[model samples]
Target: MLRYTLMRLGIFVGCLVVVWALVYSGVAPRGLGDSNGMWVVLLALLVSAPISFVVLRRERDRASERIVQRVDRMKSGLEASRNQEDAVVDGTTGAPGRTS
Candidate 1:
């Protein structure tokens, strides 16, 4: 997860630097707002999104799989704990003086 996040961030920053250079060099015209400000960031995000989608598919999938597995494990643990608690409350401990 962390690896994928860092990789995505790196790509975005790289794109941002490229955009900034283009704007600064007069190759790309500055638009509505200052290209050096939020405009550049938004442009970077737009450029990076597709680049990351195409280039980092494997990393993104791996991160998603890891997240799903972690959530599954957490959910199973919670269910088991709940079952144990329910059993105790319902008097199913199978010990002396405990009802089924």
Candidate 2:
């Protein structure tokens, strides 16, 4: 998970730097005054999304697989516990406990 997050952050930063350079060099339209930084950030996010999606495909799929396995493990454990409880109930009920 941490790896995935860091990868995404790296992509966003890369996009930001590239876009900032383009605007700084006058290749892209410059934002006026106050909104300049915000514009760069928004544009970075927009550009980073597709780039990250493509670049991080393997990591993303690995993370998804890990999450699914964890869920399956938890579900199996819960089912096993329920089955044990049911068995105990059936055993006790079938042969009632006797106190001497």
Candidate 3:
């Protein structure tokens, strides 16, 4: 989870840097005071948002599944270890020559 969050932060900062560079370099056209640049930026964001959301959601789901599976395996291992210990105790106590 931490790694995913960091990865997203990195990507966001990278995009900001690239956009700032473009604007600084005057690569985006000036709109003759019409402010069409704002509209273009908004349109780009609207289009990119859903695509980024879908990709991130898929990654998060996969990571969650992996964590769940790992936890389950650890639980099963602990249970098996406990059962083995119980069996050993039972056998030692149940022998005819043994005293409680």
On TM-score, the leading prediction is 1
Task: Provide the lowest-lDDT 10-residue window in model 3.
Answer: 39-48
The model with the greater lDDT, 1 or 3, is: 1
- Candidate 2, residues 1-100, lDDT tens digits: the string is 7899999999999999999998789888777778988888888999999999999999999999999999999999999998788778778799564332
- Alpha-carbon RMSD, each predicted model: 3.7, 5.3, 8.8
Q: How well does candidate 1 score on lDDT at residue 41?
A: 82
Error of 1 at 32 (Å): 3.4
Give the whole-model CA lDDT for all candidates, comma-separated: 0.86, 0.90, 0.65
Which prediction has more favorable TM-score, 1 or 3? 1
Flag the better candidate by lDDT, 2 or 3. 2
Displacement of the residue 38 alpha carbon in candidate 1, Å:
2.1
Which pairs, if any, clash in model 1?
none
Expressed as tens digits, the lDDT of each residue in 1-100 for candidate 1 is 9999999999999999998888778887676754457777888898999999999999999999999999999999999998788778667656555332
Best by lDDT: 2
Count clashing residue pairs in model 2. 0
How many clashing pairs in candidate 3?
0
Cα misplacement distance, residue 49 of candidate 2 (Å): 0.6
Q: In candidate 3, what are the lDDT values of residues 9-90, reduced to their tens digit?
A: 5555555555555655778554456665664455455544554566578677877998999999999999999878777887
TM-score of each model, paired residue for residue: 0.84, 0.81, 0.51
